[model samples]
Target: MAFTGFGGSTSGTTDFTQELVSATGLAERDRPADLRVWPNPTPDGTFTIDAGEARILGLEVLDASGRLVRSLGALSAAPFTMELGGLGAGSYTVRLLTDRGPAVARLLRQ
Candidate 1:
């Protein structure tokens, strides 16, 4: 199956679910080669998006329950700095809305 970017249904309801593993036991499609966040676990909210060679237009910070907590909005380019100082220390996931598709990574706030 192909990744449909972010999950949104025609019924007009919340659908934040995602398939962690495809039927083949791997991501349906490959993620950006270098799309990553540096300093996985950061004490401060300051973080950087590596971009690697991809163009990430937007970002969404989700809680462990897959609920969207914050939206970084659309970006003009990649390798940008994100200030999540408002978030509390805990486990979180950063969803990179890239030009190619979506990429998710674990983020820890200190």
Candidate 2:
């Protein structure tokens, strides 16, 4: 399957997938140019999502197995802080459904 990452490009290779990658592979590279995430390898169970001027439509947190962890339905802002303290330490995926499109990011809970 085709995958996008932080750099903004989808390679034909299966090096990545939409399931969520730590830092190397994020989504929205081919869509919204403003959606971003900080502190990829989060020391805590929280991270900030900044979508610039784009309005978020939805948000979801998924595990490596593609299981939905947390679902924040129908977002209505640009910048926000998502808390994942409920999730144990592991790799997770944060999907940002924005007006431009859906953006995926890799998250590491420590």
In order of appearance, the predictions have TM-scores of 0.64, 0.66
* Tens-digit per-residue lDDT, 17-72, candidate 1: 45444666446346553567878787897888766666777889888888888887
lDDT tens per residue, model 2, 36-88: 88788888887888877778888899998999999997766557888887688
Give the range of the ten consecutive residues with the poorest summed lDDT in model 2. 13-22
Pairs that collide, model 1 = none
Which number leads on lDDT? Answer: 2
Give the poorly placed runs of model 1, Cα more than 4 Å off.
1-33
Superposed on all Cα atoms, model 1 deviates from the true structure by an RMSD in Å of 14.5
Clashing pairs counted in every model: 0, 0
Error of 2 at 64 (Å): 1.0
Residue 110, candidate 1: Cα error in Å is: 1.8
Candidate 2: which pairs clash? none
lDDT of each: 0.75, 0.77
Best by TM-score: 2
* Model 1's TM-score against the true structure: 0.64
